[model samples]
Target: MRILLVEDDAMIGEAISQALKDACYAVDWVRDGQSALSTVHRQRYDAMLLDLGLPHKDGLEVLRVLRAKKHSMPILIVSARDAVEDRIQGLDSGADDYILKPFEMAELLARIRVTVRRNAGIAAPTLSNGMLSLDPASREVTVDGVATLLSAREFSLLQALLIRPGAILSRVELEDRIYGWNEEVESNAVEFLIHSLRKKLGSSTIKNVRGVGWLVSKGE
Candidate 1:
């Protein structure tokens, strides 16, 4: 799923972005609230991680504007502001969850999964296509009752494909989902990962759509 991270602190933003990428999420990060507001208005994201302290415009204003404009995407306030009033205000303004700074990456990921699933009206953490099963929490994949190992990039790629089985995903789309916006992508990176995944999952598991992209079926 796609996540927009609006954090002003460079170190904390970098760390959170890396952790989210490692957990198989497509992340787009911005430093200030103005850029955050613009992006939120332009594109659709599965969820957002917003920090309260921001430049140009504070994060609360960003949240208020988004809600005013009727953007229903899940927003999780991940700020250093841990005061009770801050938490209450964030929720009252439309945040789905409030996560304080110095929080565990695992907990953040768990909250992300819950928020995304809840928004999508899905009650389970596992996504399945036929005999292929993907557990988001464990980052584990199993096909036909046999366990399989995958690299971090491969897992992210597969997760993006499995999320909407049978839908064609272009190379650019796959790259966006598998890597953070700032990561340098090789020309044939998606193809390389696809090749590796096919080798392990069997050639028929993923199909090339000629010039369009690649697809995996939703049924076993």
Candidate 2:
């Protein structure tokens, strides 16, 4: 899933970004509320981690504006403000959850999962396309009842493709989902990863759309 993290503290942002990446999330982090607002307005995200204290604009104002614009994306407040009134105000501002700073990474991740599931109206842990199944929580993939082990990048690539079966995803879009925005992308990285995934999953599972992009067919 994609997440936007709005945090001003460099150290805390780095830590949360790394943790979210480790959990296989596409994260876009901004240092201030203005950048965060710009990002949320421009791109789609599964959830948001917002910090109250921010430069340029307060995070509360950011949330308020988003709600005013009718952006229904799930938002979780992650702030150093632990006071009861602060939490109440954050929720009143339309935050889905409130998490105080110095929180456990595991707890934060758990909350994110809940928010994503709630937004997507999903109650299951497994996502499937035909006989192929993926367990997002376990990072496991199974094709036609057979378990297929994949490298981290390979798994990420397949997950991205499978999530939107039959939809053509451009190389740039795939790269954005598989690798961080700051990472150096090899010229043929997407092609290489697609080749590898096809080899493991089945040669006919993924379709190349000529010059357009790639797509996982709806059924085998």
Candidate 3:
């Protein structure tokens, strides 16, 4: 999934961005709140990781502004503001979750998954479309109860489709899910991933809409 990361600390920002990439997320990071606001307006992100102490504009104002404009993507505050009131205010200002600084990367990743799933109205940890089951935590897919291994990019492409079964995603849409800023995207990357997934799962598991795009059926 795509994520917008807002932080002012160079070290922390680099670390977090790398971790997200390692976990197979497409991340675009900005070092300040103004950039954060501008970037969010220009691009679609599945979720945002925001730090409260920011330059140009503070993160709280950023959160309020986005919510005021009716931007509903999940926002998680990652700040050193540890006071109870701080947490309450961040949430009240529209943060879906709060993670204090000096936190574990594993916990932050887990929380991001929960927040994103919650926003998508998905209660189950594993995403499924009848014939295929995907566990985000394990990065594993099961076809008819049998485990199947997938390369990271393959898993990402399938995850994008299974996130909303029956919804068509064009080449650009699927590419955005698997690639991040500054990453090289080969011309046939999307086609390659889809072809690979079909072979591993089943030829008929994913369908093409002729000139439109691709989708997975919302199976029973």
Task: Report RMSD (Å) for each prediction in the order shown.
Answer: 2.2, 2.4, 0.7
What candidate 2 gets wrong by more than 4 Å, as runs, is none
Instruction: Report the poorest 10 consecutive residues by lDDT, candidate 1.
Output: 174-183
Clashes of each: 1, 0, 0
TM-score of model number 3: 0.98
In the range 194-217, model 3's lDDT, one tens digit per residue, is 899999889999999988999999
Candidate achieving the largest TM-score? 3
- The alpha-carbon lDDT assigned to residue 62 of candidate 3 equals 99
Q: What is candidate 3's CA lDDT for residue 177?
A: 86
Worst 10 residues of 3 by lDDT: 143-152
What is the lDDT, from 0 to 100, of the residue 171 in candidate 1? 91
Candidate 2 Cα lDDT to native: 0.85
| Candidate 1 lDDT, 21-125, residue by residue in tens | 777777899999999999877766878999999999999999999999898999999998888999999999999999998999999999998887787666778
lDDT of 2 by residue, 156-176 (tens): 777777767778999988887
Error of 3 at 52 (Å): 0.6
Q: Evaluated with lDDT, which candidate comes out highest? A: 3
